[model samples]
Target: MKTRITLLALLTAWHAQGQTLTENSMADSKDIERIVVTGSRIVESIDEVPATITIINRQQIEKQLKVSPELQTILATLVPGLAPSTGTSSNSSQTLRGRSPLVMIDGVPQSTPLRNGALGIRTIDPNSIERIEVIKGATSIYGNGAAGGIINYITKKAHADSKFNGQVSLSSRFSTAKFEDSTGQRIEGMINGQLNNFSYVASASFEENGLQKDAEGDVIGLKYGLSDAVMHNYFTKFGYQFNDDISMQLVINHYQSEQDSNLVDVVGSVNSGEKTYAIKAPAGTDAPGEPQGPNNQNVMLKYTDQALFDNTQLVLDAYAQKVKNTFFYSPVLANPEQGYDGGQSVIKSDKKGLRATFNSLFEWDDLEATIIYGIDALNDVTSQPMVDGRVWVPEMDMENVAGFLQSKWLIQEDLIVKAGVRRENIDLAVQDYKTLRLCKSVDICSIPMAVKGDTLNYSATTYNVGVRYNIAEYFQPFANYSQGSDISDIGRLLRTATVSDIADIQTQASIIDNYEIGFTSVVDNLRMEFSAYRSTSELGTTNKYDPATGVYMPVRAPQEIYGYEALAHYQLADNFDITATYAWVEGKDTKNDIYLGAKQISAPKGSININWSPNELSSMSLTYLYVGNRKRFDTVAGEHVGDKGPINSYHLVNFSGQYQLNRDWQAFIGIENLFNQDYYPAKSQAYTYSGYNVKGLGTTVNLGVQYQF
Candidate 1:
């Protein structure tokens, strides 16, 4: 309690000092300029929004890419209140604000909510992205599957500096602990130009990853891992300016990643927390197949007209996407009736959508306001099937229509209020299918069951309201209330349904309500921000592993969650700057009165980053991250019974630097886990049911060179 009071007092004093500085040095100091588009459909200054928003510019993205090409790792280091990476292509245990956030490339959704593939974060390449925008808390601005927030990856745009311009780059990566057979390579090329009324940008890249090792010089297990893989990415964008008020653009992106592993998992003892291994299985053993990763293709077309009417704007967008993700082969049971020894399943999804929006400005008396209205239409089809063409989860089709209205009122020069509401209607149709059953022997067998198909309809209404007061150029305070809704594991429910009608399945959509209050201040060379939020759901979803079926089942219950975040940035000298951030979160299942595990509630975490620029030709950065202690369970009557017992604290350090040899040539190098810290990730430590705890990677280095023409 004393610590809390001291922190609050310091914050208040800082705000007062900032206000005084702004008043005295208004003409000398310049405020930072940042534009964002995720919180609202239109581009606006970040300070104008009544929410917590984080932006990663091109320079930051490139610097981080030099260290690691994994998007999950980059986001985990930068975004507050987000869980750490799972050291794989799948983000099974990572969550934003204690819930799943919708991942999007440009303006198109990449997540398969119906089946929950947990592969959306790896759908795009980091080299092709120009910027990333993250909005925190519940929001329904972009429609379904945003129960937590939104992550938007903006692609590169054409450069108008010259008629033709391009760059070529190459990099090599290797593990310092064990160098043999642990080397990887990457190559990338890009071109952009603008001629007359037409502009175009194109990029392509390929990467090869080798085996990973731990600090003890032991090869990490290959089961459901990301090492020993090949990745390919291609992206292109074209734009045409027909007139001053009219314009159109088209974008296309394709990405694929496949794994090649020659070993299988060897389970370890659960009581000792010993290391796991990957050993060569028997000759006839069923091993994982090649190309066991995500494959995605996305395309979009957009048109905008600014002169549709007086002081009015019109924008239209059409998009389509196809995604498929393959899982590792599992030898759960042997079945002779279906002519199959084991099962390998894949989840496939196809989506198409259209969005139309109109914005208008109005002025009456001493009041000024802007109104935005839009409509969304979409169709989605998803299914899961095995390698031998057997149905695991029947195909499901859905059609949705939605409309929304949002308005912002500038009541005074220093006060603004905003409100919005949306209505959604959806229809889903499914066909009759049969479930798979395997029998290792007559004593151990699963009975094949028949499932009936039906059509279901659902409707929901969501709303948001907020107010922001700008006290000065250096201080702003805001408060808001928002709502988000999403369908909960529709495919899983359908596959396990025993009734004939869809209504009798006992599954319903989840609606989450969020309330937040925050403040932002900028004074001289320092910037600070703090926010507190609470989110609740009348019917929450909980996942548990069923040992009998070897599958995870979802249960519904009431939930309550809350968290807080604080960030500070300061310029220590002319050539040095530092940033510090802290986040804390907690969640509880109200019905059962049991605290949620690490999967839902991440430990309190913090980070500090230092950047130094001795000259315009060279720069360096060093970062340190710390995850605090987390203990959610205790011994009950001499028996260990909670989710996973407890998890210990850990720390990591990383460094990267760049030197410009000349105007047209440059070199860079990066080191990860600089101290060779031996630790386990929270996901591995808390997952007791799996009986295998994976260790984090050891020290690694990457070196690269670039040539511009």
Candidate 2:
């Protein structure tokens, strides 16, 4: 009773601060401020870039965190052209611009491209991030695994101006419909400061989640679930300035999240209209397997010289990463003859890389140009093996070497042109292995075949060109064409091989060609942007269901994908503003003349945001999201096959607020699904696989307080 009363009291006080509005609380200008962007592998002005990039700063991140601590929620809420989150531990259904994107931290890659376990998005906790930069187009800027673009997380740095600075935060989460066992808690702390030429920052965080319940007060399904989960993260960075022109920095991070559920999944069939859910288990209903999640570790060292040779800038980065992801147990791994009823699999990867870049600046009368050239070398070893001593995919050792040159030119201070080219060479080696003989029943099983493995080689050259015209303050136009390659996902192909000779395997490097055109307009208190894009590849990356084997078989076919996106923002009053965004995408297999399934495409999505800041001490925001229906596949004999089920529309509303109660304390609250809407997420509705048609989160509330020192 006291806790509820205290929460109401805090809410009342926070609401009172916004009861009256004044002109002093309004913004003074309509000018759209610009920030530096690192999407091009260099810090450049936003207006100078020819593509759409979303930059979420620290203030924006903090505001969003008040509503949900999950990184998937934040990405779905802020990024356009990205699929909605699956509301689970896996991101297999989430793609950027109808394709998979490469995730990175401080320019170091975190994704396991060799096999793509789809667990890269949650490698690090959101609290350790200083900002998120998203580039929404294809290019060879950093190398392969960027066929859809790049999502880079920049880490926090020390407060060099102060001797010591720190912050501590505590928060709680619970379901509004029922709070019996649906509660969670989080604790986090960070410290940073500077001494002489040395600066350092460090942080630690921990969280434990209780059971998850739906709007109907039923426990959510346990497949890929987050119930009864525990997480821990540690991060640190140190820097030393040798002189005014040279410096070095070192960074280390470790993160782990695993679900140890007490409730078991009550599997349901989608065709029968039975939704999957969970319940309190009877005696010994718990499944056999290790907890499902990821364990990731990353280390990086950087050296910078601003005055290299007195005319160029030099930056060198060396990084290493180790990753492991475990999936839930299933009967698909049953091999009765081999003394194994069922088992689970784990994907393990290790990567080490080095990058060296040189930037040169030139100015001649009215033309100013910048040239950037670099070389990247990396080695990655990845494999998938069953927990019960069996190899599903043999270990693959890959070595990649690449060189790139990019340049930007500004002519007459009104026209900008950018171009770049990259050359890549990759080699993969695998030993001989045999395919798993998975059985659906005692009498029915897949044929086991001995496969031959040898070294494979691939080489490609990609190019990009673009132009941006600053015609006037009210209008700007841009156009660009770029190229990138899809590499290292061949592990899926090797595992499903039907041939015995390594030379007869039908596979090749998938070269991607991307084209884009867009424009931005800023008039008075309104700003708008629109862009259209098209991407094509020789081999499509998609999988089809094999009912006999209970497996998803990979399909290689020619593909074409196209999409469009729009954004608009208007300031209604000095203290109020509104923004809207929309995205639509479609894809088809050129060879078969059939629409691609949900695995590679997403339904139309839109969102509107209303922000109000009555004073510096208080702020409030309300957001609305809408997903439209999309049906591209016809049912075969009244059964939706594979991942091509029909998708239905849904709506959601969210609210967030924060108030400064005192000089050293702050209180905040966030409510997701404010109206407690009952619906299925897009991915849940599009996949007919068992134990997948789960409900989205209901009315969930988050409350927290922070102290600054």
Candidate 3:
């Protein structure tokens, strides 16, 4: 209660002073006064939008350069509703506002839900991004699997005004004895040019990861185990001015990663025994561990604003992604008695998808209404090799199609109405296969005797509605009711078997319904927003895995969650600026007899962040975050189980700053977890209890130099 009052008072004082919050201040002046993309169909001021959206501009990214890695390292520090769980190895994933939100880069979907040790989240480098847009809460505008929210990474676009401009920067780091070559470096370069009616922008970046160790100089379990990887990112964009009334842009983005690690079998024994000894043999090694040798590529073609009608704008986007994994797996250690094999295995897959949108705005009855509609299609194929590098399962494919319609109505100068709906259709198909009894030594296995149906179909529809009103000058108050759906990628994979009929297969749909009220205020030298919300999803869709068929069944019930978020910025006098944000959330299953989603992770219940910049040449920040305890059915590897109530709240602080030594040279220093808080954000219990637990880095310090031209 005290915290709430203090925040309210601060907000009232700031707004009462008369400062206008500029909705599109983050963008350059020529871009647009107000713009809306993923949340609503119409282009409106951020203050007038019914949903909550956070925009991180280029300036913010520049400020964070002296901080930790932008991908998963500093998630909890910047975004309010997002918290990083275990993100070691390749399986690191984040929970948004307490739920999993889908991430997209230039509309290319990127997620690795089931793949063990998959580095899906580290596919992009921050240097290639121009702006980061986040829509908090359920999202139906993009269609399919936006139950929590959406994080869109917009890449840099070619500028027409610049005839030729280029930027280059080099950075390095200082390390302790924990890392063999504590020294590492990053190089980035970008160029933009415009000739006549054609304009283009291209950039490239290369960065290497440093090692982390414990106080004793020994490795700290799986914490940052795969932190020694290297990243390479390249982006290019070209825009053509067909005529005064029409123009189109094409963008292509690509990134490649090469990660090699020797921490295979790092899962030492908790109980001493011969069974605890690590396997020594190469192919027959039964060491319960995995090595890394993986890479991926993405290519996309986007045609923006192709003028079909004088007043209508259309955008067409298409892309394909291919990811390959060649790693070592020890199946014998998984099930000693029924060991399949122990050797190197490779899993390779390809995904392709396309989305197109049409937008139109016109005056009707002295009122302005903007309408947006679009369609999306996706297809994925998988092919895997056995432990001996022999082809096992033939190629399998899954496909999806969706269509959506959304609109924004400007009822009054200060009042706005928004609504939208989407329909998604999915199909899964597999090649004919027959199984026949054969000896285990045979490299090639017989195909299934019977052929399964060609296709399995699943369909669903989702919708949302909301309103925003400018109650006071520079103050916009809004209320919204939004809905979204979560369709399991694994659930759709089940229909490929020959035994099930498309009609009998039931599609599980998790529904998100949200109720929220918030206000955005801008005051001279101060900007802030405060919001409270209640969101719930029907429980029937909780993940329920069936052992008999090895399928995740959907359980229906009611799951409720509620929370609040507050953000504020204050610029005191000449150069002192401070930014802060606070957030909280609580989630529960209301109708489950037994805690079905017991081990389900919840969003953090409390968080605070403070950034201070005394001048352009120097800056620093401090942040605190707390992850509430959750109730689970059984204890997980010594970790408390049952109504665990709440895990002890942990607080962490990070510091960073930069100093300009000369006109073209600068230095940076950053420290993470200054107090060295020891805690775990994510853990799992498998086998005798084996899973990644993010061991907090006691205190890590890095210093680097940057030179620009």
Cα error, candidate 3, residue 349 (Å)? 4.6
Q: What is candidate 1's lDDT per residue for 1-709, written digit by digit as tens?
A: 2332233223222111211111222332222126565676765557668889888777778877888898988888888877887667877667888888889987689988888877888988998888888899988888878877898897876665456899998999889988977799999989988787777888999999887777776667665576678999999888777776677888899999987767677765334657675656678875555458889999988887765787667778899999989876655534667667776788899999999988776766556677889999999899988766778888989898999998877665567788999998888888877766765444555555676777788789999999888888588999999998788468877665545565677667788999999999999999999999999998777765454555455667888999999999999898899989999998999999978876677778898988899999999989898887778876455533324546788999989999999999999998888898887777666665443377778888999999898
lDDT value for candidate 3? 0.57
- Which scores better on lDDT, 2 or 3? 2
Error of 2 at 705 (Å): 0.6
- Between candidates 2 and 3, the one scoring higher on TM-score is 2
Give the higher-TM-score candidate: 1 or 3.
Answer: 1
lDDT computed for candidate 2: 0.81
Q: Candidate 2 on 213-246: residue-level lDDT in tens?
A: 6777677787778888888999998887777667
Q: Rate the local accuracy (lDDT) of all candidates.
A: 0.78, 0.81, 0.57
Clash totals in order: 0, 0, 20
Candidate 1 collision pairs:
none
For residue 265, model 3's alpha carbon misses the true position, in angstroms, by: 4.1
Task: Indicate the TM-score of model 1.
Answer: 0.91
